[model samples]
Target: MATVLLAVLVAGGVGCALVVCLLWRFHRALDRTPPDVGAFAHSAATRTAGAAAARTSSARMTNLTSALPWAVPLGTSVADSCRTEDRNPFLGPASWAPINCVRSTVFYLAFDGDIRTHLRQLDAVLAEQEWVGSGSSLNTLTGMATWLSQAGGDPSPAASQQGSTEPPGSRPICLSTTYGPATQKRAVPHGGLGLRLQVAVAELPCTPSAETGDLQTDGRPEKSPVEGTVYLTWHPLSTDTVSRSAYTAHRYVAALSLVDGYAVQSTSTTAPPSPLTR
Candidate 1:
């Protein structure tokens, strides 16, 4: 019994001593830092907060893209993949790829290019309600909408309906994508930003093709490919400069996946982090 008591005392004493030593070290480190340095760090955080406010700002739209007449995709994932790619085929400078496995109508998604570089840098926070999160919608839409209005041509509803809304070479919808089911498009205003350029794709007939060989090369799993008409639009109010260019929007087909609900977000860009993170 005495031996046990002695051991407990020793252990307790050692723990108390260790805690005291750690506290002392922390105190010393804080004391060693110059007062001016702390002031600068606080100042920096304050500035970052202001910048964060600018990124998540929101605006209401008078028109809704879904209200337009277009073919909407069915059974969720089995459709819309092509239209999603078609609407945002490239997203700035990234390349669009279909990752559908054979035997079932299922394809995963991927991208390639400089825009992919920017997307990697973006802090993507996904949710069923908002695809790219509220933080990104404001920063993405403002410029996209304005770009289409000023420089976009005909929206190139489809290959058959390719017409220049503006003079050729004067900067129309710059990406190599098509927007079928033309309608008056607008981004809905959510208190926290939502996918502004939302589209409703309809079912479209797709046949297995010869070039589908590379699609399954990745060896993901057994699944088929899907193609559908997506009814999405560009946010005329994005703050990002890249989204504002027709060239970029043309390449900006937001890579979407068929998970439950909606693909509710843009893969083209993401919202900045909170001031605290910065």
Candidate 2:
């Protein structure tokens, strides 16, 4: 009877030990497996990841549009003082200002002739501020030269230095917004385009807006993605060339689109300089 009792006791102890060992092994396997992918990230980490993704997507739009000629990044990268929301003293509710502006490359898709004749003609109709080339005063580009930016209220110092004076064929002549106001400014918003013409004295007639169909004469897309529309008729041009027809008159109209984008951002208080300021 004593031996049987002792044997029962021993069996009970062994069973308990086995159960404890199995439980520990089960816990070890669970720890070895990867954690739930979602729960592992903290809230701050998740937020940062989301913001980075959003920025990446937005940056793509800027990149795709960069293919357009005379394209520039929209920021106060110039002078460092020129801010995105620089206040304009002349017009505004709060005297709001624009910190940055973007202008397209002034290219004449099909000029009447080579750069010289075209510059002379364009200048005649254009105000002294209106030019036909590029200037490095703003930001230099490859192949073509650079030009100064236009601030409607007060022209910057760099603006005076730029004009049609640059080596004509070397780059497009300089043009400014002080020209025939909205209509002319929109035509050559940045400057003039750099012509790669081997043929001088070529004739490409202008039609109603862009209707004359010079841009379409070749493989070029009728409407430009940058300038859009064929003509810069103050607004959008209906055709590709200026109208020489008696009914349309012989006025030389600049054909282009709005180089200045959006309604234009009004000036607001800055978000404060970075803490690690120089």
Best by TM-score: 1
lDDT of 2 by residue, 1-278 (tens): 99999999999999999988887666554423221222212234323433342343234223323332222222210000011221322222222233222222212232222334443433343223233333332221111112321222222222222242323223223332221232222332221211110101111232312211123444232333221121221122222332233213221223322122211122242221111000
In order of appearance, the predictions have TM-scores of: 0.20, 0.19
User: Which of the numbered candidates is closest to the native, going by highest lDDT?
Assistant: 2
Q: After superposing candidate 2, which stretches have Cα over 4 Å from the reference? A: 1-118, 124-127, 130-132, 136-237, 240-258, 262-278
Model 1: which ten-residue window has the lowest total lDDT? 200-209
- Output the TM-score of candidate 2: 0.19
Model 2 lDDT on a 0 to 1 scale: 0.27
lDDT of 1: 0.26
Q: Following a full C-alpha superposition, what root-mean-square deviation does model 1 have from the true structure?
A: 22.8
